[model samples]
Target: MQACELNVIKYILFVFNLIFAISGIGLIVAGACVLSEVGEFSHFIEGRLLAPPVVLIIVGCIVFLVASLGCYGAIRESYTMLMAYAVCLLIILIAELSIGIAAAVYKGDFDSAMKNIMKDSLHSYNESRTDRLAWDNIQSKLKCCGVTGPKDWPSKTRPLSCCHPIREGAAPPQEFHCQDAIEGDQILYNDGCFDELKMKAESSANVLMGVGIGIAFVEVVGILLACWLASAIKNKE
Candidate 1:
């Protein structure tokens, strides 16, 4: 390649690295937000259900580190660093492809597993105040009642959190007496917590997949640029 072409490749690699670094920061912030929002539920749910965000944060940090190496290699015209950057990008590409495939193949199983976990958490809701509060928050925020709907409560009564509009302009109803009318006349939320949670999980999975594919494409371009630059440096030597 000509000197100008080599310079162009180097600058492209540098820009890609900068984008990757920014993506890394995004992942970290996203993961932290997930953790913060989940609060106590993070501990209540199984690890697999919550692993993706954490994995994103870790992988993002790794990408940032690798991108830094790429930028430095390009700027310094260091053949060794360029080779190392190419190898790192290849590894990241393989890892991301594997994860994407695995996620697709096991998507159904993951959904089922998450449902079971939610059910277990519901069953144990009364065992701890923390668990109970978590369930209340989930029910209120998701506009859901029990794992399978209001029927799961088994006592023909629902928690106050399940009451839509929360009986405004009056004293709040008792904890489990929100539905004071005939069961048919109550204004309890009709959806199930499990279904609501499942929908959320699926949405999050899609976002993660999209982000992974995007980053993988960038990594491919970066690898190509690193390899071309490394070759040019060798020829000049």
Candidate 2:
């Protein structure tokens, strides 16, 4: 390639590196937010469930380091470094694709685990204060009743957390029966915690999947650019 054409490629690679750096920071933030959101329910779930966000964070950090190396390689016009950058991008591309596939495929396992956890928690609700509090918090926040419904509670009556229009410092509306009510009242939330939790887990996984795959595409472009630049520099030499 001509000198002017080579310069143009270098310029484009520099800009691409800058953008990739920003995207690295974005991935870090996204991963942290997702981790925080899902981590709230950590008490009820296993540690492996947190893998997606953690992997995202690791990938983001890798992206930062790679982007810096890419910038340095572009500035130095080092054919060797450019080739190394391309290899790094290829490795990242593989990782991102794996993460995306895992995120997409893991929801079924997540839902099954959620069901078992919720049921076990419900069975021990009266025996454990921690479980009781957790159930209350989950029902109130998710606008759900028991594992499957309010009837899923060990006792005939559901807790106040199942009531609609959850009050912070005060009681709910006088019309709705909150505590120790007959199942026939129909005042408790109808939705099941199982469904809600499954939906939320699936949603988070989808976000991770989408982000991983999208960045993987961008990394493909970077790999191409780096390889092209490396080849052109070799020719120019």
Candidate 3:
């Protein structure tokens, strides 16, 4: 009976260690990816601006240590080590729930506001605004209103001279005779892009938070099951 209980405990620890190790690997990989491109990406988006969370790095370290302990516990039939592993898992669960709750609280407001901003921005600088007019003369043609970069840009500088808008190493096709670049127009367009980007980012975060919280809950249940299984095996023995 004692041997059977020990075996059940060993199996549980094995599973615990495996799960934590997998989670650690995922965190490290995600952190690396975000860190690699944060600079360029951050220029265009809000959440992209910051470095990866320090908490993630800390959690990863904790997972590594606890998973090692779990492996040792399983190999040696050590109840104390298994208990420690369970405690660490509980801490991880609490952190996951906290983060998910924070995200949930702010999600609705952020989403609605972003949608409105994008819609307005799309209407204002749609790049096709100038194309709406008809020109009466060839010189007037030089000022034809179509964005410089789009397919409909005037084929000849005579009908309308297209001046491609050059921005930070990226030249956007100029519509022929684009109305003078309005003051602060770039800021507005960029803001709209940011709003759209954040909407996508938040949606992805919502899914990640759901998955993470779900996993944490499962881990807690798993820890309990491991204990129960060990107890049951001992009784049968």
Per-model RMSD to reference = 2.6, 2.8, 11.4
The residue-level lDDT of candidate 2 at 181 comes to 58
As for model 3, its CA RMSD to the true structure in angstroms is 11.4
lDDT of 3 at 96: 67
How would you encode candidate 2's per-residue C-alpha lDDT over 156-235 as one tens digit per residue? 44677887774598655553356665554566688888888777876777787777777887899999999998888999
lDDT of 1 at 163: 72
Model 2 alpha-carbon miss at residue 68, Å:
0.7
Candidate 1 residue lDDT tens string, 131-237: 67878888888888888777776464456777776446876656656555333435678788878876776666777777777788888888888998899888877
- What is candidate 3's local distance difference test score? 0.49
In terms of lDDT, model 1 sits at: 0.76
**Clash count for each candidate, listed in order shown:** 0, 0, 14
lDDT of 3 by residue, 1-237 (tens): 666666666686677678767777666555444444332333223352232233455666676776777677667655566566677778887886776566567667655654454334334433544322221111122222222122322233212222323558775545433434332444112122334355446544544554466557656765775455445544644
Note the Cα lDDT for every prediction shown: 0.76, 0.82, 0.49
1 or 3, greater by lDDT = 1
Residue 235 of model 1, lDDT score:
81
Worst 10 residues of 1 by lDDT: 176-185
Candidates sorted by TM-score, descending order?
2, 1, 3
Pairs with steric clashes in candidate 1? none
The alpha-carbon deviation from the true structure for residue 36 of candidate 1, after best TM-score superposition, in angstroms, is: 3.9
TM-score of candidate 1 to 2 decimals: 0.86
